[model samples]
Target: MTKTIRTNPLFELYIENNILVINNGEDLKNNGHIKTADIESIEFIRELNFWNKILEVTFGLIVSVKSEYVRIRFKDGFKDLLVTNCDRKKVEYLVYDVNLLILKTQNHHY
Candidate 1:
């Protein structure tokens, strides 16, 4: 399955055939593919500041576009975002599925 992670104007990230596909949003420099074999791990983040976190817990709500992010970290210590400005809960599952693909790919499971 091909899952689109994010499609912001700066960059886009997706998973296709178990590979991380970087479709540079509207630009042309960042398009590329990352195999599971090349990465150390993937990380999902709720990029909220102190006030945002407080607001979320206090109000039982979150700002989707401001709080969601996914980070793809390579073995080389460089990190790339799977794009930003994401929706809450939705992007969480996408990140989870991407990690599953990473596991399968790294394990040579097809």
Candidate 2:
């Protein structure tokens, strides 16, 4: 088992044997064996909210676009595995360590 990349009360994200595992609490919600060839694209988003001329909140999202599902990771502290349609073009606003996701998915190709 690979070291967990992120963990929260609702879900844990990790890469095991080149498979992306999203463990929902004690149950196995979904897992994906990632191949770089299977990834259509990866997108990163950073969100900022302003209040009183100061940035109040920040969040990050990493979206992995595959043919079957769009994997999304929010900032490491949240406990939600957001699942939606596989339309990669429609996802918006979430956060995570983008470089980590890219590295895992890309390096697994070999």
Candidate 3:
């Protein structure tokens, strides 16, 4: 089964076919994926300042929010961004699980 975490309409996360995909699953231009074996680390950054956070938390109830970003660093020195706009705690928990899934996928293949 495919696992998914929706942070943004465009910046969604998926774990399927031994890959970590970051996209809305339809936007070809935004569709980016890193092989489970190639992921070096996944780090989250919050850019939502007080005003931005207020805007995001309140406005997000009716609109899209773009405040957090998950930076996926690859072993080959390349990197990708997964912009998120959800609750900080939820995103943190989900990313932590993503890290675990990455390790699990790598171990399974080995």
Candidate 4:
């Protein structure tokens, strides 16, 4: 059975049969199947805002290619999933782990 891998208040991410599933609030929103053979690379980016090196806060994670554009809520505010005001380390780790799994699955197919 497919199980949820990660979730925030506004989104749920699931991994099943090497495919990534995203749900919004109470329903399925988008789905992407991993084409391990076609994927050239994966990247995870942490978004931050800095001014005069005075304040820096991590907001979101941006994934190359497949997850380039996504919107998610951060705290009580809404922002692009790639540009949020949520916990940075946590989101980064989650995306990294998911990418690893995708790569592992690709390797297994060969």
Candidate 5:
């Protein structure tokens, strides 16, 4: 049987021969290399179901003609979204709707 793996874009991984490199929100330019065997676990929470679900639901809330940085606010917190090479309007709409969903879901989840 194959085990399922979870990952997020926030967590970066690179492998070279016997060396394994992992970068987690530090200086991307200064990523230190290490032995591949040294890495036993990698926890990427960026793709957590909460955020993923919000992204899916927020798919049409923006009214901008060009893509712009969107600030999404929720009941518990907020998030800044910026996806490279995407339709600006679509991204804004997604961010806006996702923010609303976050508030709605958090209320129910709690």
Candidate 6:
């Protein structure tokens, strides 16, 4: 049986073992689950301010950020690719996480 779980702005969707986990709370615990097929689509989080810098350094190229199945384009040419399935707050957290990732990568390189 398939059911659609109520999604929230702060939560993220993850699959473990054979069950889908909805992570919203601070503990990173699975609050709920639903069939994978029940998900209509995924909207990725975006870091616009970060991309602005990336754009200036890498001019003439399109930059995108991917989270789960969602892809966010920082350029006008890719705006049409934004996904509507994700809630804004949840996407915001995901974007913040991405920023942290970039920082970690930079630190490691240095």
Q: TM-scores of all models?
A: 0.66, 0.32, 0.57, 0.45, 0.26, 0.30
lDDT of 1: 0.64
Q: Identify the candidate with maximal TM-score.
A: 1
Worst 10 residues of 4 by lDDT: 64-73
Note the Cα lDDT for every prediction shown: 0.64, 0.38, 0.63, 0.45, 0.38, 0.42
lDDT of 4 by residue, 13-94 (tens): 4456655555555334344444333434344444333431233323343332223323432234433434243344545555
RMSD for each model, in Å, please? Answer: 3.6, 11.6, 6.1, 9.7, 14.6, 13.4
lDDT of 5: 0.38
Segments of candidate 6 deviating more than 4 angstroms: 1-81
Give the candidate number with the greatest lDDT.
1
Error of 1 at 6 (Å): 5.3
Expressed as tens digits, the lDDT of each residue in 1-110 for candidate 2 is 33332344344444455345555443464543443334334443322233412432233334332222234433332233343322223222212333355666667866
RMSD of 5: 14.6
lDDT of each residue in 1-99, candidate 6, tens digit only: 122222444445444443445554433443465443333223454444576658846895544444323442332322112323455555445545444
C-alpha lDDT (0 to 100) for residue 2 of candidate 3: 36
List, residue by residue over 1-110, the lDDT tens digit for candidate 1: 44444445544466766577776665466678877667767777766778878888899885554544467777668554544554445556766777777787767844
Candidate 5 — which residues are off by over 4 angstroms?
1-12, 22-30, 47-110
**Between the candidate structures 1 and 6, which one is better when assessed by lDDT?**
1
Pitting candidate 5 against candidate 6, the one with the higher lDDT is: 6
Tens digit of per-residue lDDT, candidate 5, span 1-110: 11111134343334445453434443355345654233322221122245445655687432222322334333445333333333434443433433444445446657
Q: Which order, best to worst by TM-score?
A: 1, 3, 4, 2, 6, 5
lDDT of 4 at 61: 36
Measured by TM-score, how close is model 6 to the native structure? 0.30
What is the Å distance of residue 11 in model 1 from its true position? Answer: 5.8
* Pairs clashing within candidate 4: none
- What is the lDDT, from 0 to 100, of the residue 43 in candidate 6? 40
Best to worst by lDDT, what's the order?
1, 3, 4, 6, 2, 5
Off by over 4 Å in 4: 1-9, 26-42, 50-80
Clashing pairs in 2: 60-94, 60-95, 60-96, 61-94, 61-95, 74-95
